[model samples]
Target: MGILTSSKRNRRPSRNSYTVSSRPSSPSGAANGKSFFAHVKTALSWTLGLGLGALLLVGLALGGLHLHRLATTSDFFAIRRIEIRGTTHFNREEVLKAANLQVGVNSLTVNIADVERGLRDNPGVAAVAVKRRLPDAFEIRIRERIPAFWMLKDGVLHYADNRGRTIAPVSVGNFLSLP
Candidate 1:
């Protein structure tokens, strides 16, 4: 009897003592803890990846701007010749003056839209097209407004187009033949 009692005392405590309460231990508690950590890790990974991608895009944009500046400032793209086309009422010098392009200016640096707008502001120009003929030239095409009739306004003869816009003052030699 004494030996049996000693053997019982020597035996290790049951696994139930690992928990503070008498409630049965569940594997689900450990799994829940692991899953929470996994979720945190996944969120952090996505955040880091998105941040890196944004940085890469900004770097590419800056690089493109730098390259564009270099190409526009290079001498090889200087404007040497300006070809004026589709002009009948306006001379080449008049079109060139409206364009305001300077010889030896960088072709790529010219603002075509501004040039077109300046030409369009002229009373005689109906439309204008400006293009860079790569390497050293610009081609300008002008469409002139035609005078449709002559109007006598304020005791002065004025030439007018189809839109009723006054083009210029008519002289005896200019619009006298047009009844």
Candidate 2:
């Protein structure tokens, strides 16, 4: 009983307390939660700016697509003439037939490498160079293989170049007296 009384006399009891503060707000009266409204206004402005930027990007993309369509399909881009250079073994008709090209085709639709590949498929063609004359023409230069020997195959004679590479089969139109 004496020990209990001594501990109770030395210890102090705890109590609850409240505090008050004076925080400053904007110079313009912000009593009605104006700070919240300002935050909302800034967020809306950012969203609106982002939306406008996206719309501008979409408009530019659409404009580019429209211009590409117009350029590729317009008659103004149609080929008017084709110039074939360096043709020795094949004629103009044969070269065009090999390249599968014709006038009035869209210039933009023509693939230069494809045309060269088509011409190179022929055994007589050793090398090829193709050029596009903008807005309506194409120029192709073909280096033909000159026959270094005459090869006889199954009673028919074919043209052969220096490396024993066979050229086209000899026909009346492309006949050459080669040893």
Candidate 3:
């Protein structure tokens, strides 16, 4: 597009007055009114669209935060049952105490890494996985260290692994004797 401007000069007894005018920058656009209005309309529509998109993005982020807060702190997500798996050495109470889990606690507030770390503190836990089943349950999977031999130290029976490390203490009610 190009601009075409004209000026009109008038002479007076003591002063000169000049007037300036403007037209479309393009020669073809000067005669085409519909195309010019259409371009303006399209630009307006595009600006409105971008503004709406930004509003929706902000709304979604805020809604997600509110929902997350609800999910984490609500009593509806309290723990009701805990399912323990793949444990032949450690019992349910032992595992729960090690993982620091108790019934009626908020399930969503439980941290997987912290639970895994607590479980790993047990000498018998070779590998452990903790998962939350939303709204009321948890799944605990464990891989226990195999005992290579039994050791009696300080009048206590302890199970030792192949690396000569103490795996766990032998319980009276439940005992696995190893030569």
CA lDDT of each candidate? 0.82, 0.87, 0.86
> Model 2 off-target regions past 4 Å?
1-34, 153-156
Off by over 4 Å in 1: 1-48, 147-151, 161-165, 170-179
Give per-residue CA lDDT, model 1, range 62-115, as digits (tens): 999999999989999999999888876677667777788888999888899988
Top of the candidates by lDDT: 2
Error of 2 at 69 (Å): 1.2
Candidate 3 has its poorest 10 consecutive residues by lDDT at 7-16
Ranking by TM-score: 2, 3, 1
What lDDT does model 1 reach? Answer: 0.82
Candidate 2, residues 68-119, lDDT tens digits: the string is 9999999998999999988776889999989989999999999888998999
Q: Global lDDT for candidate 2?
A: 0.87
Given candidate 3, what's the lDDT at residue 66?
A: 100
Which is better, 2 or 3, measured by TM-score?
A: 2
89: Cα error in model 1, Å: 3.0
Q: Tell how far residue 64 is off in model 3, in angstroms.
A: 1.6
lDDT of 3 at 124: 84
lDDT of 2 at 15: 46
Which candidate achieves the best TM-score against the true structure? 2
Better of 1 and 3 by TM-score: 3
